[model samples]
Target: MTGRAHRDSEADRIWQMLVGLVWETRGEWRRKVSEATALPFSRVRILWRLVDEPKTLTQLAVSTSDAPATTVAVNDLEDRGLVERHPHPDNRRAKLVSLTPAGRRLIESARRTVRDDAPPAVQQLSKTDLAHLRRILERISSSER
Candidate 1:
């Protein structure tokens, strides 16, 4: 193979490995969070997004990338007293969703669960190795923007 083709093939292999690792770690994290919080991964995702501030259903839909699913999840969260809707100050027709105290507590617990439950392979990384990995990952992430 030509040099360019070889480089592309190597890049593809690295990309695939990175993607696989991410998906596996994400799945494990999701499972742990769900078990810890007794909530579905989707609901947990919405709660995490709301941790910063209140948002309209439309905003949540956009962030979640599924308007219909976001609406249903919000309804469920509201019914469970984990979230509440308030009138949007700027738009009379819109309501802003915010996490309730219960929701906040659950989210805190979820955060702890995730923090304490790093996958075995990650947990085994030495500090020096982890720092190097962090730098590489940060560079990759920064390139996206």
Candidate 2:
């Protein structure tokens, strides 16, 4: 708090701070991943997306907001034997994406950082604040339509 009259309100400042924090957080995450893991960020995201359920390449690309390179990423993973793309159960032409044993193992290793290193950070936040923040962020992330 200073005498300077910032045109922005406290909420705006907090929002911008959170954005910068996100960049810092992701940067750190990327560095650790690059150092400790062989998978690329895009490959990891595709694998994580399928953790819930299988999806076609089209669905994965749209859901992940990945562009044309989705094929390249998925293909790379497939070539590495990390993921297997096969004909969609319902649609012959479309291909479904899922994790192979290798893919799941890779994501499992990534989770070690969060589980082993971040529980204390999570404990510092009040449960109510964490819940409220999650709700707000989820609502904001929904499609505008």
1-145: candidate 2 lDDT, tens digit per residue: 5545554577689889877766655766766765556766767778889887878888888977666788898889899888898788788899888889988888788877533243345558898988997898788789554
All candidates: CA RMSD (Å):
2.9, 5.5
Best by TM-score: 1
How does each model score on lDDT?
Answer: 0.91, 0.77
Q: Which ten residues in a row have the lowest lDDT in candidate 2?
A: 113-122
Model 1 CA deviation exceeding 4 Å by range: 1-9, 91-93, 113-116
Error of 2 at 91 (Å): 2.1
What tens digits encode model 1's per-residue C-alpha lDDT throughout 1-145?
9999999999899999988877877876778889999899999999999999999999999888688999999999999999999999999999999999999999997787676456688889999999998999899899987
How many clashing residue pairs, candidate 1? 0
Error of 1 at 129 (Å): 3.1
RMSD versus native structure for model 1: 2.9
